[model samples]
Target: MTWIHLLSKSHIPFSVYKMYKGDSLIQPKTIKNTHILVILQGILSMYHVLNKTEVICNSIVYTGHIITSNDSDYTYNYISLRTSYIISLPITTTDLNQYIDHKIFNQILYNYNNTLKQNIDINRIFIHKNIKFRLIQIIIILSMKFGIIHNQKIMIPLIIHKIDLANILGGNINTINKILKDLDDQKIVTYAKRNIYVHNIVFLKYYCYLLR
Candidate 1:
Protein backbone atom coordinates (compact mmCIF):
# COMPACT_ATOMS: atom_id res chain seq x y z
CA MET A 1 0.00 0.00 0.00
CA THR A 2 1.13 3.53 -0.70
CA TRP A 3 1.39 6.38 1.75
CA ILE A 4 -1.56 8.10 0.05
CA HIS A 5 -3.72 5.03 0.66
CA LEU A 6 -2.59 4.88 4.27
CA LEU A 7 -3.17 8.56 4.81
CA SER A 8 -6.62 8.31 3.36
CA LYS A 9 -7.59 5.30 5.46
CA SER A 10 -5.94 6.18 8.73
CA HIS A 11 -7.24 8.51 11.43
CA ILE A 12 -3.95 10.25 11.87
CA PRO A 13 -4.25 14.03 11.90
CA PHE A 14 -2.50 15.92 9.11
CA SER A 15 -2.32 19.52 7.86
CA VAL A 16 -2.01 20.13 4.14
CA TYR A 17 -0.25 23.10 2.62
CA LYS A 18 -0.40 24.25 -0.97
CA MET A 19 2.42 25.92 -2.87
CA TYR A 20 2.74 27.42 -6.30
CA LYS A 21 5.68 26.87 -8.57
CA GLY A 22 8.78 28.73 -7.31
CA ASP A 23 7.17 29.27 -3.93
CA SER A 24 9.35 28.76 -0.89
CA LEU A 25 8.08 26.75 2.06
CA ILE A 26 10.13 27.87 4.97
CA GLN A 27 10.81 25.51 7.85
CA PRO A 28 9.50 26.91 11.09
CA LYS A 29 12.28 27.63 13.54
CA THR A 30 10.24 27.00 16.67
CA ILE A 31 8.32 23.88 15.90
CA LYS A 32 7.39 22.67 19.36
CA ASN A 33 6.05 19.35 18.21
CA THR A 34 7.95 17.08 15.85
CA HIS A 35 6.18 16.30 12.61
CA ILE A 36 6.84 14.25 9.52
CA LEU A 37 6.46 16.07 6.20
CA VAL A 38 5.11 14.08 3.28
CA ILE A 39 4.88 15.19 -0.30
CA LEU A 40 1.36 14.27 -1.33
CA GLN A 41 1.73 15.82 -4.79
CA GLY A 42 4.28 17.64 -6.97
CA ILE A 43 8.07 18.00 -6.72
CA LEU A 44 10.28 20.05 -4.42
CA SER A 45 13.97 20.70 -4.00
CA MET A 46 15.20 20.73 -0.42
CA TYR A 47 17.97 23.23 0.14
CA HIS A 48 20.30 23.85 3.06
CA VAL A 49 20.91 27.49 3.86
CA LEU A 50 24.41 28.50 4.82
CA ASN A 51 25.18 31.79 6.65
CA LYS A 52 21.60 32.84 5.94
CA THR A 53 22.54 33.46 2.32
CA GLU A 54 24.19 30.61 0.46
CA VAL A 55 21.85 27.77 -0.48
CA ILE A 56 22.84 24.26 -1.47
CA CYS A 57 20.21 21.93 -2.89
CA ASN A 58 20.69 18.52 -1.32
CA SER A 59 17.94 16.45 -2.86
CA ILE A 60 15.09 16.27 -5.33
CA VAL A 61 12.01 15.19 -3.41
CA TYR A 62 9.12 13.60 -5.25
CA THR A 63 5.68 12.46 -4.19
CA GLY A 64 5.49 9.88 -1.35
CA HIS A 65 8.85 10.78 0.13
CA ILE A 66 8.97 11.53 3.87
CA ILE A 67 11.09 14.22 5.47
CA THR A 68 11.89 13.95 9.15
CA SER A 69 13.08 16.63 11.53
CA ASN A 70 16.47 15.02 12.02
CA ASP A 71 17.28 14.93 8.31
CA SER A 72 19.02 18.27 8.53
CA ASP A 73 20.52 20.24 11.38
CA TYR A 74 20.36 23.48 9.43
CA THR A 75 17.25 25.27 8.29
CA TYR A 76 15.65 23.85 5.14
CA ASN A 77 13.86 25.70 2.39
CA TYR A 78 11.63 23.63 0.16
CA ILE A 79 11.07 25.21 -3.23
CA SER A 80 8.33 23.93 -5.45
CA LEU A 81 9.17 22.98 -9.02
CA ARG A 82 5.45 22.45 -9.64
CA THR A 83 2.27 23.10 -7.74
CA SER A 84 2.69 20.92 -4.62
CA TYR A 85 0.62 19.60 -1.77
CA ILE A 86 2.48 18.71 1.40
CA ILE A 87 1.06 17.26 4.60
CA SER A 88 2.56 17.50 8.04
CA LEU A 89 1.80 14.74 10.52
CA PRO A 90 2.77 14.97 14.12
CA ILE A 91 4.50 11.73 15.03
CA THR A 92 6.69 10.69 17.89
CA THR A 93 8.74 7.58 18.67
CA THR A 94 6.46 6.64 21.53
CA ASP A 95 3.37 7.31 19.45
CA LEU A 96 4.40 4.75 16.85
CA ASN A 97 4.02 1.75 19.14
CA GLN A 98 0.27 2.22 19.32
CA TYR A 99 -0.13 1.59 15.58
CA ILE A 100 2.52 -1.11 15.21
CA ASP A 101 0.05 -3.66 13.92
CA HIS A 102 -1.88 -1.33 11.66
CA LYS A 103 -1.34 -1.07 7.92
CA ILE A 104 -0.98 2.70 8.21
CA PHE A 105 2.09 2.32 10.37
CA ASN A 106 3.45 -0.42 8.16
CA GLN A 107 3.10 1.70 5.03
CA ILE A 108 4.77 4.61 6.72
CA LEU A 109 7.67 2.38 7.70
CA TYR A 110 7.94 1.03 4.16
CA ASN A 111 8.09 4.48 2.61
CA TYR A 112 10.55 5.67 5.22
CA ASN A 113 12.83 2.71 4.57
CA ASN A 114 12.66 3.25 0.81
CA THR A 115 13.48 6.91 1.28
CA LEU A 116 16.56 6.03 3.30
CA LYS A 117 17.71 3.50 0.73
CA GLN A 118 17.27 6.01 -2.09
CA ASN A 119 19.29 8.59 -0.18
CA ILE A 120 22.10 6.11 0.27
CA ASP A 121 22.11 5.31 -3.44
CA ILE A 122 22.22 9.00 -4.31
CA ASN A 123 25.08 9.53 -1.88
CA ARG A 124 27.04 6.76 -3.57
CA ILE A 125 26.66 8.51 -6.91
CA PHE A 126 28.61 11.46 -5.54
CA ILE A 127 31.62 9.27 -4.85
CA HIS A 128 32.33 9.04 -8.61
CA LYS A 129 34.09 12.03 -10.15
CA ASN A 130 32.63 11.61 -13.62
CA ILE A 131 30.13 14.43 -13.97
CA LYS A 132 28.67 13.06 -17.18
CA PHE A 133 27.86 9.71 -15.70
CA ARG A 134 26.50 11.33 -12.58
CA LEU A 135 24.22 13.65 -14.56
CA ILE A 136 22.91 10.86 -16.76
CA GLN A 137 22.28 8.56 -13.83
CA ILE A 138 20.36 11.32 -12.08
CA ILE A 139 18.22 11.86 -15.18
CA ILE A 140 17.55 8.13 -15.36
CA ILE A 141 16.46 8.10 -11.75
CA LEU A 142 14.19 11.09 -12.28
CA SER A 143 12.68 9.56 -15.39
CA MET A 144 11.93 6.36 -13.56
CA LYS A 145 10.39 8.23 -10.68
CA PHE A 146 8.41 11.00 -12.37
CA GLY A 147 8.88 11.17 -16.13
CA ILE A 148 5.94 10.76 -18.45
CA ILE A 149 5.93 9.14 -21.88
CA HIS A 150 5.14 11.69 -24.56
CA ASN A 151 5.50 10.94 -28.27
CA GLN A 152 7.72 7.96 -27.41
CA LYS A 153 10.10 10.15 -25.43
CA ILE A 154 10.54 10.36 -21.67
CA MET A 155 9.84 13.92 -20.56
CA ILE A 156 10.72 15.12 -17.11
CA PRO A 157 7.93 17.66 -16.63
CA LEU A 158 9.34 19.59 -13.73
CA ILE A 159 10.58 23.12 -14.31
CA ILE A 160 14.02 23.06 -12.80
CA HIS A 161 16.62 25.83 -12.90
CA LYS A 162 20.11 25.30 -14.30
CA ILE A 163 21.66 26.49 -11.06
CA ASP A 164 19.69 23.96 -9.06
CA LEU A 165 20.77 21.20 -11.41
CA ALA A 166 24.37 22.24 -11.07
CA ASN A 167 24.08 22.33 -7.27
CA ILE A 168 22.58 18.87 -7.14
CA LEU A 169 25.22 17.40 -9.48
CA GLY A 170 28.13 19.36 -7.90
CA GLY A 171 29.30 20.63 -11.28
CA ASN A 172 29.87 24.06 -12.74
CA ILE A 173 27.04 25.69 -14.68
CA ASN A 174 29.20 25.94 -17.84
CA THR A 175 30.26 22.30 -17.55
CA ILE A 176 26.70 21.16 -17.09
CA ASN A 177 25.59 23.18 -20.09
CA LYS A 178 28.38 21.74 -22.22
CA ILE A 179 27.51 18.17 -21.30
CA LEU A 180 23.86 18.79 -22.05
CA LYS A 181 24.83 20.39 -25.36
CA ASP A 182 26.87 17.35 -26.25
CA LEU A 183 23.90 15.12 -25.51
CA ASP A 184 21.68 17.36 -27.61
CA ASP A 185 24.18 17.26 -30.47
CA GLN A 186 24.02 13.47 -30.42
CA LYS A 187 20.18 13.64 -30.27
CA ILE A 188 20.12 11.57 -27.13
CA VAL A 189 18.29 14.23 -25.13
CA THR A 190 16.88 17.71 -25.54
CA TYR A 191 17.42 20.04 -22.59
CA ALA A 192 16.12 23.59 -22.69
CA LYS A 193 15.27 25.95 -19.88
CA ARG A 194 15.41 23.10 -17.34
CA ASN A 195 12.99 20.81 -19.18
CA ILE A 196 14.59 17.53 -20.24
CA TYR A 197 13.26 15.32 -23.00
CA VAL A 198 15.19 12.08 -23.19
CA HIS A 199 14.76 10.66 -26.67
CA ASN A 200 17.03 7.62 -26.35
CA ILE A 201 16.82 5.97 -22.95
CA VAL A 202 18.79 2.98 -24.24
CA PHE A 203 21.63 5.17 -25.41
CA LEU A 204 21.74 6.95 -22.04
CA LYS A 205 21.88 3.65 -20.19
CA TYR A 206 24.58 2.21 -22.42
CA TYR A 207 26.61 5.40 -22.20
CA CYS A 208 26.54 5.16 -18.42
CA TYR A 209 27.66 1.54 -18.64
CA LEU A 210 30.58 2.48 -20.86
CA LEU A 211 31.60 5.26 -18.48
CA ARG A 212 31.84 2.87 -15.55
Candidate 2:
Protein backbone atom coordinates (compact mmCIF):
# COMPACT_ATOMS: atom_id res chain seq x y z
CA MET A 1 0.00 0.00 0.00
CA THR A 2 3.11 2.21 -0.07
CA TRP A 3 3.83 4.79 -2.75
CA ILE A 4 6.51 2.48 -4.19
CA HIS A 5 3.97 -0.31 -4.52
CA LEU A 6 1.59 2.14 -6.16
CA LEU A 7 4.31 3.12 -8.63
CA SER A 8 5.05 -0.54 -9.32
CA LYS A 9 1.42 -1.03 -10.24
CA SER A 10 1.47 2.09 -12.39
CA HIS A 11 3.25 3.07 -15.62
CA ILE A 12 6.50 4.18 -14.02
CA PRO A 13 9.36 1.70 -14.59
CA PHE A 14 11.99 0.45 -12.17
CA SER A 15 14.59 -2.32 -11.92
CA VAL A 16 15.28 -4.56 -8.98
CA TYR A 17 18.99 -5.40 -8.66
CA LYS A 18 19.90 -8.43 -6.60
CA MET A 19 23.51 -8.68 -5.39
CA TYR A 20 25.28 -11.22 -3.28
CA LYS A 21 27.92 -10.40 -0.71
CA GLY A 22 31.15 -9.06 -2.26
CA ASP A 23 29.51 -8.54 -5.59
CA SER A 24 30.47 -5.44 -7.53
CA LEU A 25 27.49 -3.42 -8.68
CA ILE A 26 28.61 -2.04 -11.99
CA GLN A 27 26.53 0.96 -12.89
CA PRO A 28 25.06 0.58 -16.32
CA LYS A 29 26.90 2.84 -18.78
CA THR A 30 23.70 3.76 -20.58
CA ILE A 31 22.20 5.56 -17.60
CA LYS A 32 22.14 9.30 -17.97
CA ASN A 33 21.03 12.23 -15.82
CA THR A 34 19.89 10.58 -12.56
CA HIS A 35 18.35 7.51 -10.94
CA ILE A 36 16.99 6.89 -7.46
CA LEU A 37 18.34 3.84 -5.60
CA VAL A 38 16.26 2.44 -2.80
CA ILE A 39 17.87 -0.21 -0.63
CA LEU A 40 15.23 -2.85 -0.03
CA GLN A 41 17.51 -5.18 1.93
CA GLY A 42 21.11 -5.47 3.24
CA ILE A 43 23.94 -2.93 2.99
CA LEU A 44 26.11 -1.37 0.29
CA SER A 45 29.56 0.16 0.54
CA MET A 46 29.97 3.11 -1.75
CA TYR A 47 33.58 3.95 -2.56
CA HIS A 48 36.09 5.11 -5.14
CA VAL A 49 39.12 3.06 -5.98
CA LEU A 50 42.43 4.93 -6.15
CA ASN A 51 45.06 3.59 -8.56
CA LYS A 52 42.79 0.54 -8.62
CA THR A 53 44.35 -0.42 -5.30
CA GLU A 54 43.01 1.62 -2.41
CA VAL A 55 39.30 1.80 -1.78
CA ILE A 56 38.20 5.09 -0.27
CA CYS A 57 34.92 4.30 1.40
CA ASN A 58 32.50 7.14 0.75
CA SER A 59 29.45 5.94 2.61
CA ILE A 60 27.40 3.02 3.84
CA VAL A 61 23.87 2.71 2.42
CA TYR A 62 21.44 0.95 4.72
CA THR A 63 18.06 -0.64 4.04
CA GLY A 64 15.21 1.77 3.19
CA HIS A 65 17.57 4.67 2.43
CA ILE A 66 17.05 6.51 -0.83
CA ILE A 67 20.18 7.42 -2.79
CA THR A 68 20.46 9.76 -5.75
CA SER A 69 22.83 8.73 -8.51
CA ASN A 70 23.37 11.73 -10.76
CA ASP A 71 26.92 11.20 -11.94
CA SER A 72 27.05 10.08 -15.55
CA ASP A 73 30.82 9.82 -15.17
CA TYR A 74 30.33 7.09 -12.55
CA THR A 75 32.99 8.26 -10.11
CA TYR A 76 31.85 5.91 -7.36
CA ASN A 77 31.66 2.14 -7.11
CA TYR A 78 29.06 0.28 -5.09
CA ILE A 79 29.81 -3.10 -3.55
CA SER A 80 27.47 -5.35 -1.64
CA LEU A 81 28.55 -5.93 1.94
CA ARG A 82 25.79 -8.51 2.35
CA THR A 83 23.20 -10.09 0.08
CA SER A 84 21.11 -7.11 -1.03
CA TYR A 85 18.04 -6.06 -2.93
CA ILE A 86 18.12 -2.61 -4.56
CA ILE A 87 15.34 -0.91 -6.43
CA SER A 88 16.59 1.41 -9.15
CA LEU A 89 14.03 3.89 -10.34
CA PRO A 90 15.31 5.68 -13.42
CA ILE A 91 12.97 8.55 -12.80
CA THR A 92 14.37 11.80 -14.08
CA THR A 93 13.70 15.27 -12.73
CA THR A 94 11.37 15.88 -15.64
CA ASP A 95 9.46 12.72 -14.81
CA LEU A 96 9.24 13.66 -11.15
CA ASN A 97 7.99 17.16 -11.94
CA GLN A 98 5.44 15.78 -14.33
CA TYR A 99 4.12 12.60 -12.72
CA ILE A 100 4.67 12.63 -8.96
CA ASP A 101 2.82 14.82 -6.48
CA HIS A 102 4.88 17.90 -5.73
CA LYS A 103 4.93 17.33 -1.98
CA ILE A 104 5.84 13.65 -2.22
CA PHE A 105 8.50 14.22 -4.87
CA ASN A 106 10.05 17.02 -2.88
CA GLN A 107 10.12 14.81 0.22
CA ILE A 108 11.97 12.05 -1.65
CA LEU A 109 14.65 14.44 -2.84
CA TYR A 110 14.93 15.94 0.66
CA ASN A 111 15.43 12.54 2.26
CA TYR A 112 18.17 11.58 -0.22
CA ASN A 113 19.96 14.90 0.27
CA ASN A 114 19.75 14.60 4.06
CA THR A 115 21.15 11.07 4.06
CA LEU A 116 24.01 12.08 1.76
CA LYS A 117 24.77 15.07 3.98
CA GLN A 118 24.88 12.90 7.11
CA ASN A 119 27.34 10.49 5.47
CA ILE A 120 29.54 13.39 4.38
CA ASP A 121 29.41 14.83 7.87
CA ILE A 122 30.51 11.55 9.42
CA ASN A 123 33.51 11.36 7.09
CA ARG A 124 34.48 14.97 7.73
CA ILE A 125 34.16 14.63 11.51
CA PHE A 126 36.34 11.52 11.69
CA ILE A 127 38.95 12.36 9.03
CA HIS A 128 41.35 13.91 11.52
CA LYS A 129 40.58 11.46 14.35
CA ASN A 130 42.75 8.49 15.27
CA ILE A 131 42.32 5.17 13.49
CA LYS A 132 40.94 3.46 16.58
CA PHE A 133 38.40 6.22 17.03
CA ARG A 134 37.39 5.94 13.38
CA LEU A 135 37.06 2.15 13.64
CA ILE A 136 34.99 2.37 16.82
CA GLN A 137 32.79 5.04 15.33
CA ILE A 138 32.11 2.93 12.26
CA ILE A 139 31.33 -0.10 14.42
CA ILE A 140 28.83 1.99 16.31
CA ILE A 141 27.30 3.20 13.08
CA LEU A 142 27.03 -0.32 11.61
CA SER A 143 25.83 -1.84 14.85
CA MET A 144 23.02 0.68 15.03
CA LYS A 145 22.17 0.32 11.37
CA PHE A 146 22.42 -3.46 10.83
CA GLY A 147 22.44 -4.98 14.29
CA ILE A 148 19.89 -7.18 16.04
CA ILE A 149 19.28 -6.83 19.75
CA HIS A 150 19.92 -10.14 21.48
CA ASN A 151 21.02 -11.25 24.93
CA GLN A 152 21.08 -7.64 26.11
CA LYS A 153 23.72 -6.81 23.49
CA ILE A 154 23.98 -5.73 19.88
CA MET A 155 25.04 -8.41 17.37
CA ILE A 156 26.08 -7.28 13.94
CA PRO A 157 25.19 -10.24 11.69
CA LEU A 158 27.23 -9.18 8.68
CA ILE A 159 30.46 -11.00 8.05
CA ILE A 160 32.68 -7.94 7.93
CA HIS A 161 36.34 -8.77 7.52
CA LYS A 162 39.39 -6.90 8.85
CA ILE A 163 40.22 -5.86 5.31
CA ASP A 164 36.76 -4.38 4.98
CA LEU A 165 37.28 -2.27 8.07
CA ALA A 166 40.72 -1.28 6.85
CA ASN A 167 39.29 -0.20 3.51
CA ILE A 168 36.52 1.75 5.21
CA LEU A 169 38.79 3.64 7.60
CA GLY A 170 41.73 3.83 5.14
CA GLY A 171 44.00 2.15 7.63
CA ASN A 172 46.59 -0.60 7.36
CA ILE A 173 45.30 -4.16 7.79
CA ASN A 174 47.77 -4.94 10.59
CA THR A 175 46.77 -1.78 12.42
CA ILE A 176 43.10 -2.66 12.10
CA ASN A 177 43.84 -6.17 13.34
CA LYS A 178 45.68 -4.80 16.38
CA ILE A 179 42.85 -2.43 17.18
CA LEU A 180 40.31 -5.24 16.96
CA LYS A 181 42.44 -7.34 19.27
CA ASP A 182 42.59 -4.47 21.74
CA LEU A 183 38.83 -4.06 21.64
CA ASP A 184 38.40 -7.80 22.14
CA ASP A 185 40.84 -7.78 25.06
CA GLN A 186 38.86 -5.04 26.75
CA LYS A 187 35.63 -7.02 26.25
CA ILE A 188 34.10 -4.05 24.42
CA VAL A 189 33.48 -6.17 21.33
CA THR A 190 34.03 -9.77 20.30
CA TYR A 191 34.89 -10.84 16.79
CA ALA A 192 34.29 -14.46 15.88
CA LYS A 193 34.70 -15.55 12.27
CA ARG A 194 34.34 -11.95 11.13
CA ASN A 195 31.01 -11.48 12.92
CA ILE A 196 30.98 -8.66 15.49
CA TYR A 197 29.20 -8.79 18.83
CA VAL A 198 29.15 -5.59 20.82
CA HIS A 199 29.42 -6.56 24.45
CA ASN A 200 29.61 -3.05 25.89
CA ILE A 201 28.12 -0.45 23.58
CA VAL A 202 27.97 2.07 26.41
CA PHE A 203 31.72 1.84 26.96
CA LEU A 204 32.33 2.05 23.23
CA LYS A 205 30.23 5.26 23.09
CA TYR A 206 32.07 6.73 26.08
CA TYR A 207 35.43 5.92 24.49
CA CYS A 208 34.34 7.43 21.20
CA TYR A 209 33.21 10.62 22.98
CA LEU A 210 36.54 10.86 24.79
CA LEU A 211 38.40 10.55 21.49
CA ARG A 212 36.28 13.27 19.94
TM-score of each: 0.83, 0.85
Candidate 1 stretches greater than 4 Å from native: 1-10, 26-33, 50-55, 93-101
Runs of candidate 2 exceeding 4 Å displacement: 1-3, 27-31, 50-54, 71-74
lDDT of candidates 1 onward, in order: 0.77, 0.76
- lDDT per residue as tens, model 2, 1-212: 24367556555677788899998765543466466777778788777645456557777776766755666554567888889988776576777665676555665676687678767866764575599888888889888877898788799999998888887787889999898899889889888888999988889999888887
Tens-place lDDT digits, model 1, residues 29-67: 445447788888888777777657687666677787776
On a 0 to 1 TM-score scale, where does candidate 2 land against the true structure?
0.85
For model 1, state the Cα shift of residue 129 in Å: 2.3
Lowest summed lDDT across 10 adjacent residues in model 2 is found at 1-10
